[model samples]
Target: MSHDDLERAGFKDRTRVAEALETVLGAVSGHDRTDRVALGRADGRTLAETVTAPSPVPGYDRAAMDGYAVQAADTFGASDRSPAVLRESDDGAVTPDAAVRVHTGSDLPDGADAVVMIEETETVGDEIEVFDAVAEGENVGDVGEDVAEGTELYDPGHRLRPSDLGLLKSVGVDRVEVYDPPTVGVIPTGEELVQRDPAPGEVIETNGLTVSRLADRWGAVPTYRNVVDDDPNAIRAAIQRDLAKDVVVTTGGSSVGERDHTPEVVDDLGEVLVHGVALKPGHPVALGVVEGTPVIMLPGYPVACIVNAVQFLRPVLKRAGNAPVPDLPTVEAALSRKISSEPGTRTFARVRLREADDGRIAEPTRASGSGVLSSVALADGWVVVPEGREGYDAGDTVAVENWEWSA
Candidate 1:
């Protein structure tokens, strides 16, 4: 009995465990630091201020159709059988429709009531004609029709997307105020873990790289630490090494096993807010505060690490950065096999997605144990199995999580 014992001591099911963790987080006040940053470097950053239209999207009256800008009265009696065209006002505004030529997106001439599309007009002698009646303002996109002046373009805390950046450019927002992201320190524990290059029989340490990649994806900087052993003193020293960071994330020692020393170190240095959660394969997820900075202890399991990152830690990161919490990418797919879960805890099962004849099929990945990192790499994503449910049935519609492809 260790962290699991603590987890079971407090939670009857995974739902209770998650609910309590959220409750604690809800009670914690957020710390935010907002500053203006150049839009070039703000690709994935969150906005701290709501953006309003400096000017209308188009800013003036423009044409939606390609044709001759003319007075609607000029074509009032025109029909499919008969068309009318006016060769007047070739220079009244931006030159009248002397040639009855207009391209898409050109501005409508002032005082002109409508446009006769070239496709609809036919040339008879030196004049062109509209075969159909032209209505006033029919082919014109009125000023601010697409987006009005003084309107909000985007709300605060919006995580900028490529399209969002393009829209902001349209609004002439070259820079925006955004909450600075909290730097999370990533420390991989265990004497056996080796960085990048490893000797024979020694597995390469990947927690730092994977966590760093995820942090980068979420618009946060992940500071990698030198590998430390599972000793409380060494871990404390490691925590102090990155105390300037806003959050500290440690891998390993979350479980209360004989080799687990992270919990002991956190206990010695700072209060461990949580020792266990009710989530399967990740029940030992821990959260605490060290030297006035938030600390997140993720289980060393890769899939489990990713799961809690989505469930428990991401919310805090979003709040602290004032970023728009992106919705988890998901889709409805049928289960390929019947899977069962223990009655008291939620399980995030590694799943492989397949394109079936009818729809997608989600099957559990091989090497789904908590210690399996290979399974996480090969998985399409994780599936949430709720506590208290027997399991999902074969062909049952269940939610399947997918990657958020944000560039």
Candidate 2:
């Protein structure tokens, strides 16, 4: 479209939450790589291929208790009043008239179809008196009972959990092919931004580190580049350098102000697919592609940066890295106070969640301004106020997105 069309489309063309995510992710998918990692280090990594069991768990039919292994028929008539005395065998074998002593997990002796608990038997010299009868297969763990051999244990795209790694080890698997996480480059842009020890008028550059960590949590390898001045040429050079990585993220220069040059810089090098999202606190967000790599531009405010990261960048990395999209925990919370927001924009209201006598309560942090960094740090999570609605009333039950870190 031409500049006039773009201008006419302005903020009123805010992309919905789902559409923005779909658009960003749709453009960044199909970029994952695969690598073989040791089973010990495979936790939290997505499987690149299916894994089948090499061997059945408990490869042998073993005793499930410390008892005597005997033929089920041999103990049928045995009771406390009429005990059946049987000869004991030293070797792991049981005859029709004899029983074999076996401990828990010991392979069931040949000719034994059941185990009689030792507590039910009284030991006499060279013989065991049985008082209870055990049926065939009772208390016996059969071969392949836990996990069958040659079974498809884990499928491609399965994210390994701690127990998943344990299961792999149990199935005799030592190595697995996992999707290599995408490499994300974060560039913080602003002339007034300083890396450390900001003066009174200067702002500290924290978005790069914050976004880098968030990307890392999304299962991507993040590289935080140094702060770049707001100059269009400087931002352009930074973007060009960061294109070496799988995805590039720029913070602070996404707005339409004169100093906000990320959109122009990205457009000069490649194409800006999305210049503005319809989400509040993150409306200035931008999604673009440079040399076939995704480049996401975030708003300068800490809260907006975080919200856009979760709304846009998270999904992109999830697809590009082949990681399963995280379903953030949510809670039904009663709004402690009323929240006011403009119509036509989806708003993310920072909230501090508290458990009260009535129930879980969501107290608004009132940190809608993009520059309100403390609001995000103090919030437990946020509530999404959908577009076309003025706001939510007090005492309204809303779904609050819970932060996994806080939990």
Candidate 3:
């Protein structure tokens, strides 16, 4: 490859980010693999089937507080001045002018319609004085109070959290059917990549490690492969080797440089839905499908690689794993300085947030190059400049989104 070839391979018209994502996702189908796991191991897994409560929580009437159970009619006019005198019963049943001891979460005594709190009752030998009156059903937890027996707990595609697991267990659900996590193969391609010490042209491999961790965080099991040299046959062989994975992600060799050959090899193997996108710092990213598996080609630049991964690969994993994709968290802040952007391209400007007299301030990082990994690592979040806007002027309000946040 030569410089002339690179120029000839330049993108004529780049696809919009939304259209590119839709095209990539349209080629993928939801995964049908499922596993039955205990509630202890169900956290962070997507539900494969609808889950309904088998039995209502608190199946029987229970006490909501530590108190003395009594019939409401017996203590109708009880007060601090003229307390109602009742005899304490050792039996587990309460009758007229009788009280039974009960604790929180304990079953209500038989024949008891209400409970008088311990603070409102005074113990005198075998006799108890009730200072306050409670209505029927007061301080009592009825059946199905927490969850109804036929109520839907979760629907398919709902990701289970720690709290969700606890709720399921409370409803007598010891095991649940969850979707199996998608499997991903991360391949790093570059002739200059090395493991450790770099001698002149050699550089350490980091994209594969970073992308593999991101895949795991997004609920996919990732297999990190050794770096492959920048050769067409080698790249094609590497991609073919990982066809069994639900997704194949390649970092580097995605641009139109002289050594870039991943896009060509992928096109030869399968159809390339998108070659370039209207995204800043990562416009050379590509999306393709080979043998029913989605392949993502990310740029070699560290920041560009991360941006493209969050935008494309994250959603791909969610779709394959049958999980919902959530929007990133954002905070409104005033721009401390101007941010320049192309009219037709969307730019993500790294910004550091700070407290100001008026409100929060978004200060753009000084080192804003695509290759500066620390700019994004050290900053709070990035401010997205839409394709229609040219740039953001100083003091303009913008939304700084934490792209690394997971649902």
Candidate 4:
């Protein structure tokens, strides 16, 4: 590869981040793979089919408190001064003017329409004195109070949580049909990468490990492969081997340099929808599709690779697994210092948050380079600058997004 080749291969115009995301997401179609997992293991899995209650929760009417079951009319107009005297029923049935002993969650006796608290009634030798008036159906847990029969509990693509599992169990759903987690093949390509102790002119691989862990955190099954050299044939073979996966993510060898053979190989294998993006620290990323599998070419720099992976690969996995992608959590804070960024390019400036006398403050990290992994690793969150803005000034209010926070 000569200078002319590099110049020709270089990106003439970078696409906006929003445009690239839309293009990649448009190519992804919903997968049909599903798994019938037990309710105990269904947490964090996306629901594949709509789940409805088979039977109403608490099917039978029961007592809501430890009290005496009595007819509403028997306690009407009763007061502490002149309490309504009623005979205690030896049997569980509550006939007219007869009160039955009942505890919380106990099934309501036949012919009982109301309950009087034990404190409100005084039992004296086969006789009961009701001091409080009660209405029909008062202090009772009605049928289907917690959940109705045939009620829609969860829709397709809804992520199950621990509380959701409890509700499913309450409705007699021991097993649930959930969408299978998307599979991701994480390949790190670089001739200088080494597994063990690196010699001169060699570097240890970290992007593959980081990306694979991120994929697992995002609810995808990731297959982390060994490092591949920057050879066209090797890159093509590695990608072809992982075409069975839902998404293929490769780190390094994606730029326009001579050693960057990933972009060309991906172009030869399939069409490259996006070559570069107008985003800070990750402009050399590429998005393509090879044999209906989405391929994400991330930059070699650790920070850049993480940024591109979160922006591109995370959403792709969510789309393939039929899961909803939500916005990252953010908190409002005041910038302690000014941060500069190129116009028409989005910037993610890492910041450390701290509490101040007035409010929270977001201080930009000292090392703000693409290759400085510690800048992001030690930071609490990042402040995003949109494409339209040049930069943010000191004391400017910004939203610090906590990307590591789980939903």
Best by TM-score: 4
Candidate 1 clashes between residue pairs 3 or more apart in a chain or in different chains: 79-131, 83-130, 84-129, 84-130, 89-96, 90-95, 90-96, 91-96
lDDT of 4 by residue, 109-212 (tens): 99899888888988888799999999999999998999999999999999999999999999889999999999989999999999889999998898999999
User: Which candidate should be chosen as best, given lDDT against the real structure?
Assistant: 3
Candidate 1 lDDT by residue in tens digits, 1-407: 34556545653333356674675465344457777988887777777788887777787677788877777766778887765555644455423434346677887776676777878887776677678877888788887887788889778777777788887777677988877876778898888788768787666777767776777677777888878887778988998888777667888777767677787677668777776777777777777776667677888776677777767666666655666567778878898888777777777777888898898898878524777877767888777788878677888988877643331
- After superposition on all C-alphas, the RMSD of every candidate to the true structure, in Å, is 3.3, 2.5, 2.5, 2.1
In the range 1-407, model 3's lDDT, one tens digit per residue, is 33245458686578889999999999988889999999999989999999999999998888888999889998989999999999987677999989899999888889998888899999988899999989999999998998989899899999999999989999999999999999999999999999899999899988999999989989999999999999999999999999999999999999887798888888889977888899887898999999999999999998999989999999999999999998889999999999999888889999999998899999999425888888888999899999999989999999999987755
lDDT to native, each model? 0.73, 0.85, 0.91, 0.90
Which residue runs of candidate 3 sit more than 4 Å off their true CA positions?
A: 1-9, 356-359
TM-score of each: 0.88, 0.91, 0.93, 0.95
Stretches of model 1 off by over 4 angstroms after superposition = 1-17, 27-31, 90-100, 196-203, 403-407
Clashing pairs in 3: none
Give the lowest summed-lDDT range of ten residues in model 4. Answer: 1-10
Order the candidate numbers by TM-score, best to worst.
Answer: 4, 3, 2, 1
Error of 3 at 45 (Å): 1.3
lDDT of 2 by residue, 128-226 (tens): 999987899887999999999999988887889989999999989999999888899999998898978989889988999999988888888999988
> What is candidate 1's TM-score against the reference?
0.88
